[model samples]
Target chain A: MKPVEIIDIDVSYGAKKILEAITFHADAGEILGIIGPNGSGKTTLLKAMSRVVARDSGEIRLDSRNLDTLGYRELARQVAVVPQDISIGFDYTVRDIVMMGRHPYIGRLASETLRDVEICDHAMHLTNVAHLTGMSIHDISGGERQRVLIARALAQEPKILLLDEATSNLDVSHQVEILNIIRDLTGKITVVSVFHDLNLAAYYCDRLLLLKDRKVYATGTPEEVLTYENIREIFQMETLVKPHPLTGRPYILPVYTHQSGVGTNRRVHVVCGGGTGSDILQLLHAAGFTVTCGILNVLDTDYGTAMHLGLPCVAEPPFHGITPESLSGLRECLDDADAIVVTAMPIGRGNLDNLRVLLDYRTKPIILYSRNSNSPMEDYTGGEAAAVLADLETRGALRVEEAEELLARLSQGYSGRS
Target chain B: MRRTAFITIPALACTLLVSVACAAALGPTGISPGSLLSLPNAWTIIWDVRLPRVIAAALVGCALAVAGTAMQGLFRNPMADPHIIGTSSGGALGATIAIVLFAGAGRPVFAFAGAMAATFAVYFISRKRGKIPVETLLLSGIALSTLLAALLSFLMYTAGRSLHQIMFWLMGGLWNVSWDDVIVALPILVGCAGIYLFARDVNILSLSEEDATHLGVNVEGLKRILLVLSALVAGIAVAVAGSIGFIGLITPHVMRLIVGPDHRLLFPAAALAGAILLVWSDTLTRTFTNDMPVGIITACFGAPFFIYLLRSRMKT
Candidate 1:
């Protein structure tokens, strides 16, 4: 059993103080999750525990030994730290890199022993990177590289493992795969990981430490530390907490904005593609207009941007063609709207029904661009579409040249153009 | 891997042998390659004249490449060139003072002294604000190199009759290399390589000073050893080969691209590659037309590749 303790430790990079008077302790055979926003000193605290980052004032102790007093090899044997940014920038093969973890175990004149090879091989197999042992590090995908890094640490055979935001760049499935591995290793090895995802921490970590403004805000079991009030205070985001369906741990649903002052009047449905609604949604929301978007995919950079902007955007899985269910969802969002604005995102086969829906909503003012007809969907521009759009333009539908013009026209406090 | 290693080792050996043969065959009066192998005077000339020059070139090449590779690893930057930290110019200034002011008396000793002094100065300056900032290393290197280059030029302008000899030395020629020059330069080169070869302890040192110390590496001591070794090798090399360029910078870089950035592999690969590249460069300088300074041939080929790499990195 290993005991890790941080006693009022403070850390600073140059003049900028990153962590302040942080005190915590982890019992043997426990998993500790540190959760915070970007640049919030979560990684810094882990580094300090691993003795990778020097603490300015307080002492970090491991198994009753002062951290600073231990030699590198001694520390390497006890605490294996997977750094937040593991950049294998060269052409070393996966196996070769994993063997670097054995650096502390071998003597100067001696080659790697059979036991070292066995440890590394076991780590590779456990991490599921044995198939990629011969591949150069530069040639592997980011997810595969993350596994290799974890394998390297495992090869060290440390009693305590420190991972700093180790799964941030991975996809959801890979993230779950890594978290499960960390979970399975918990009783065998003490695990500490800096995490940004509260749900993941709640799922895997027995205890959670929340950092705020470079100080430890709270620390306890996941249910205690990951509450709505604590998360609202630490992350500066209001959230609704409920039991997770599977694990029954507290799951947080973000409460974006209070609707009291913001108008619920003049609700508008947006047909957004290629990130076009980002500005329009923001501008409309600022003008007290309620807006919802559809025909966007989750993996698009735009979806994240829209989520950041707190828009109720309907998203499909990436590369999956827009289904009838999504089209129906878009129609339902449009049914309540007084008007619609079509931003000049490229239209294609996946989203031609959005433009067709616009044609059916003849009373709604349709704004098209001159250069916007270059969509990949022929239905959007070919056939009798040109003449139909021309008739619509002459009758009531308007055409705008710029995004700013579209926003200004939409937010004139009323839908009078139609 | 064994095949590559065998092929490379023999190729280096063959190149060294051929360079010695060619340099021996051509002199004040031409001696053919076959005739030199047979005659006793030609054999002595070969040993006394061409052998030392060839050995000097190979040793200096290995030394400069090892130093350059170590510096690049320390910096974690691929674009780092030899003399980016001003060691070469400092060594040049030292050699110039020894040649022009001291009149080639105690030249190698004084050059080594100047080189060490310049290195310490650069180190102290880089470490001043408690961190060895990469920008500080690069900028200060440029500043010191320019300053030393100006001082060297001043020494050149004031050297009344010895200006021509100093200029030729500065331009890097192996024409006048002798057994004594070989004896003086080879030990320093070999010693530096040996010390660097024992630098597995330093392999764990981070690209940054702070990280290295935290990793339990004696950062100050390692930096001092590295800078001193680089200067010793460079000072001896400049003392022998004048200011031969590119082998120090290019050989290390090419080696890094082939073997990973791990210093254990990088250092030795650089030394071997440098030995091969310079021996061939000297051979080219000998056979291409006139017995030109090997520096001219290296820079002509290496500069374009360097520029192309820089542009490509920028594009990426």
Candidate 2:
């Protein structure tokens, strides 16, 4: 059964509608992440669930019971909320702060029971703050304070826990550590947290609810909700979404659009293979050149980089020699180019056709990047590929050893042309 | 800290006992312990005058100190006190009005009513939506207190013949208090007991109202109850002693430094410390000059200590 259900909730403050018709349910024993841009009412929605802020219209049910009808103590016993930030006025000890979470259970004229102390101790241990019990709250770092607050919430021992940007103040490693702790909390208590970092949410949350324009934009697993198109629409920003190498979950890299150079209108065709052209492609792309890379094997790392960058590419099947069809595709990419960049990839019999294709494009403005001397011994084609490269250089191709000089020479050529 | 409390409570009790004995002995006509046992006149002087005054001073001190602690916790501000929040000024104004009009019995009733009115007004004015923000509460208290002080000055200026009596009472001395004055302290004791019962809730409330509410405290209800109780205690103390200053403000803070911010220990400790402070201040006044008001002695010492605290707080 769902432990928390919010249905058709509308929240407004002084006629400002912060959230409208918000509806979702947290499944038992799952981590649900609420994600949205600033002012999308993610924190407001969490506060409404915690009853810190009242909803204008709607029903919130905890374990099929109406939230409004539950007494404050009863609600606290079932759900605990870790606020975004707290500024304590006095020097309360860490243990003092955490033990306050047991306020709902302890009665007047009664001290903390042995069981209450045990729960508090277990919470402190879980948050890795057991040793800081005697320390003042002001003496700790921001990350440690956040853990203490989470420990305070854990001391409540509720069936559901709500966090409102609990890790926002933490550094990257602490962010991961806190999220991992919360991730472990799932299956024991349903965890619902509002996250500012999409990657951390994607990594930790079992399901995500995306808020946009004060409403539920989408809700699903990370793979479904964190699509590039959805992010582009909701956040109004361009990003590349790919599977994380370690976790295979969706990871987002914001595409940097701050382009500056003379190549805004220029197109460059990169002739590279075996990952040699990957750096050149990125440099040229970042320099605002409309770049096309050709004759890379379909499964080559450079080919994958090009695909990830959303650049047009000419490709062949993995482990296959260059064919007439691929060479023809490279010739077409070479045809529309203002310049050509040939990276210093080792030539073998399998890619000897790439050299032949470059020879055909000798009349185009070509820049060759070779960090080593153009020696025949570097060729596996019995000097045939080197001879072709020499012929292409004699045909007025510029030779450069670095991508920076390549970009400089291209900008110079483009300026001269203009 | 527990060891400190264990040592401090009994130590303060012993100090209070010695101070009360010394205060009961050092009146205008000094009563030696031997003479008090032998002479009937010395016994009459001790019983009829000094004994009631000392008991009244202790009760009034305990009431004001406990009220101050509660006010500080309720407002979540260390600087909060009964005097600064206009409760004392309101009581003083009520007593001055009674002296100018009905003279004798109207003072306590009017003073209590006025103090309750001022406290509720501050509470109501500071409230926004459903919660009382600390900044607004403090600002409203200062504003209302200033206004009440102005009204009090106007009353003092208008009093033609009873002005001397009004001034002496406003200066705050326990010299004229009788056993009937001590009888008025019973309700203040009950109010303080009510405040102590909700001490845990007050601790949670001091953190933040939102936190207290989430932790199952009916924050609004608790605030209302504590505010009324604090006002009742402050009003009774002011009615009986005529606006004794600084015992409410300094005692709780000094006790907090000794025992920490936990109100369970701070409350009782502050009560004992306050009783000791006022009993000694009254004793010092009596020993120095028979006519000197106890409020003058307290303010002379308290004002400097208050400045020192403010300066030290600024350094931090």
Candidate 3:
């Protein structure tokens, strides 16, 4: 199959040009993701590609045929679109809704044949929504409804599928699950989707099309397109680009700095648990300390909250416990630190060794706060765990009453606080 | 959320049947229910006079509702009515001209002519080069209706002694309905039903013009057919009964609230509901007082309901 080419397309609504001089080609079987901020004409571009929006002067071609020459039925046979908003107030069953996709194939007064029903069944099964066949489209869940829409598009059996923010309202698992299905469809069908989640786009799309000011800002593989400089230029955000450990995809981490007379003076490092280290990270910043957090996985709420607050955090893959690499990364952070705060966290088999990293650094005073029974890190002081805790206690790590007491001691020039 | 379609259909049918029976029962001279069936002439009179009028009422009701539903979908607007596309004004203008120019001639033919003309005019004015601006279609229809209303008023003024007859026609009534009028309207109503059988396609058109076009519907052709069919029904209804108010505009809206937006069910249900509503309204006018017109009765009920809908929509 030949590539879909958009050549020097310019689209304007009234006097304002929404898209300006766009040129590109999307090959068959390529999963291309378009990313841009609001009002950047991502939707307008999609509309142009579908030949729904009139361009000022340009040509869009599919398999060497100018899109303008192709009839609507012919276009429908090749491209099926799943819009972001499906405003259906009609009383159509899920099956009926999906069957509407076969409209281009069915005769005007003809009913669906056995083959049409089979195709619809296959589409529903692929979307895992056959159970909703008898249900009204309005009566289903948003996630389920979204899947049904996908199923409807799939039933069209098009060579190219266009999805505009398909996973916007879905939950985390649903988002990942839907994107996986879309990814798996890449080799069989050309896919173009608009995504707001940068990480998701990085993980799924073979190539990223970043639109800036109605122009194609950059287009390449995730690694080339997701660089820190390009993101700062296109998205207008200052962030750090780091590589994922497993997939090695580039992930973004934002940095936020506060200006204070105190911050200019000192710097502190925290080894904390259950995200209790957040306050110390904040206070240290308010008091002019350069702080960094580490070893927390991507799913940890504290890690997310930290990122939202614009802290420089080093997070690991979340599991039942921390890995050796996480322990080493935490130790490296501890070594570079002027002071260390070891907050009371549940000593599980995964992270018991995390606390043990404080053992190697003997010179720095380690502030150990008593674990409240209600605290998450309170459980599982085992044979090895007990020995580790005893050894730390014997080493004269300051046993503190509360986080505030530790802060007070730090203010008095002792060492650090958790 | 759960709907009982079977029960709803029968309940509406029963109401329509009862309303028709009552209308026949309460004429200038009170006719006995038993006597109605006994006399063969009485049966002919009821079927010919009362039944045609009732069927006309029902068919007109359905036509207006279906047209209204189609217009709403075509414009992707909620408050749109069947007549908003200048069909009624055009039809009325056509009927008015035929009454003035070819008085006592076949009024239905002229009325249909004027209606089709007005529909085409509105269609052209709204179309720029080749593209139909949905917003422009609405604004142009409003402008045309206002212009035609002014012309209609001028014609009424020059009509002089004929004004009384013209005024009655303007206000609308089914008093003079006969088998001939039914004969005239049957084909139009049948045509409307045939057009409405394509209601499933109209559902797709309601989403977006682009979506409709891409889905293999001839968007422009479908629009033209729907508009012409709606005008025919409206024109024939007006010619048979004269400017009957509210049934065309109100019935479809009420049906939508119950049945949702699927036009397949909505069109037929609205037709039945409109038929029932108008029949009962006509019955009330004939039984309670001979002084008022059927249009007046419909307006009396429709205006407040329309206001209520507008107010509620605003709150949402």
Candidate 4:
């Protein structure tokens, strides 16, 4: 069952509507991450849930009860918020700040009981801020202060905790540390945090809500919501989406947009294997060339890089020699290419067809990148592959020693394709 | 820190006792130590004249300092005081109106009403949506205070025969205050007790309004209650002793530095420190010169300290 449900909420500041018809529900014992661009009402949504800002029209239900009917103290007992920036201008001890979270549980004239003190102490220990209990908050580091604020929220013993960019100011290690703490609290407490880091949200949150235009653009698990198209539409930036090798969660790599040189429209087919063509393919694709790779085994690292870059490829099954049908598919790719570039890859019996396909396209403008001068050592084909490479060079194939030299030659040879 | 508290509370209590005794003993007609053997004359002077004034000073000091502490906590700014948001000027305006027109038993009532009006005006003006941004509230308070001060000067200029009385009230002295004036201080005592009950809430408020709300504090309601109570205490203090300066502004700050920001300890400490400060300052005014206003002495001490606070805050 959902612990909290917000239905058709609308919030306005004066005449300006900050949020419109926003609806979502946070299940019990799950972390719901809110992700959006700035001014998309991410923080405003969190504030509305915490009742810091009153929603103009909507009903918020906590534990199946209408929120407006609950007293502030009762609501506070259930929900606690750790704000983005907590400025400790005065000298308040860490213990004193944490003890403030017990305000809802204590009576007006009564002080904190022994049990209350133990809860605060346990919260400090959970956040790793117990050692700084007696120290002034003003004297702590920023990361330590963030932890102390989280600890303060935890001391509320709240069933639901709301964090608004709580870890934005921390370094990577601290961010992971704090998020790990929140992640571990999932089974006992519900957490709804606004995250600026997409990767961190993907890693830590159980489900994600992407907001756009003051509404929920998408909501699902991280693998379902953090898609390249959704991110491109919302954030208006091109990104590469790949799965994390260890966790299988979606990871985002931002494509840099500051390329200066004019890119040509020429198509280049790279014939290489054993990870040699990875850098060449990346460079050519970044230079705005249509790149394709061919006759590569499916499990090869170069094929993996190609799949990650979304380039079309002709491939065979893992550890299988190139068949006649695959060689025909490579010829079709070579036919569509304006130029061909081959990297310094070892020639082997299992992939001898790759070198033979290159010989067939010898008349075309082909650049052979032989970084290793001793080609005989890589000839697992017993001088047959070496003899074929020597014949290709004699048939007017361009010999380049480095990737940069290969790029310089390609750009020079294909200038008119622009 | 607990050790400091153990020694400091008793030491402060002793100093307050000694100050009260010394202030009662030294006056225009100095009671000689040997003359204390004659109980009749000494008792008459102590009870009739010096005792009332000393008691009045202590009450006014305690009221103003506690009100100032509440104001500072409400605004979450150390520089905030009773007068920063025009509450004192509002009370002064009310008192001036009473003296100029009614000239009777309606002074405290009118003053309390005026202070509440000013507080509500600033509170409403500074509010946006549901939250009151501290910076906007501070700026609005300053703007309204300047406006109120102008209106007060105009009223003073127009009062022909009551001009001296108006100036004396505005200057804030403790002369000729009988037990009748001390009766106005009763509300201040009640208000201080009421504020102490919410001392924990006030401490949470010092963090931020939203933070306090998350901790189950009704921030808007708490602000309203504290603002009204502070204005009441400050208004009564002004009504009884005129508009004494600096005791409210400096005493709470000194106490906070010594006792930390825990309102539970800071409030009582500030009350004691304020009572002692005003009693001594009033004594100095009476002893060093004849019938000089105590307001001048407090301002003389308060103005430089205010500047020093500003400079130190800037450096930080």
lDDT, candidates in the order shown: 0.72, 0.84, 0.74, 0.84
**Model 4, span B39-105: residue lDDT tens:** 6688788887888889888888888899889888887877777766678778888877887788646
How far does residue A327 in candidate 2 sit from its true spot (Å)?
4.0
RMSD for each model, in Å, please?
Answer: 12.5, 3.2, 8.3, 3.0
lDDT accuracy of residue B202 in candidate 3? 83
TM-score of 3: 0.72
TM-score of each candidate's B chain against the true B chain: 0.84, 0.91, 0.86, 0.91
Among residues 3 or more apart in sequence or in different chains, the pairs in candidate 1 whose N, CA or C atoms overlap within 3 Å are none
* Ordering by TM-score: 4, 2, 1, 3
Against the native complex, each candidate's DockQ, computed on alpha carbons, is 0.10, 0.64, 0.27, 0.76
Best DockQ among the predictions, by candidate number: 4
TM values, all candidates: 0.73, 0.91, 0.72, 0.93
Model 2 pairs whose backbones collide:
none
lDDT of 1 at A111: 68
What ranges in model 1 sit over 4 Å off? Answer: A258-418, B1-3, B26-40, B100-106, B116-143, B195-224, B256-266, B283-291
What DockQ class does candidate 3 belong to? Answer: acceptable
Q: TM-score for model 2? A: 0.91
- Best prediction by TM-score: 4
TM-score of chain A of each: 0.63, 0.90, 0.67, 0.90
Candidate 3 residue lDDT tens string, B1-316: 2265546667777877787677677665567878876776887767767778777777667666766777676656655564566777777777777878787587877777777788788778877755455568768878987787678878867875366555555567778877787787786667667777667678778766766765656677888888777777878877777766667668777777676666766777777788888777777787678747887888888778767866876796
Clashing residue pairs in candidate 3, if any? A262-A287, A262-A288, A263-A287, A263-A288, A321-A350, A345-A377, A346-A377, B62-B271
Q: Which rank order by DockQ, best down to worst?
A: 4, 2, 3, 1
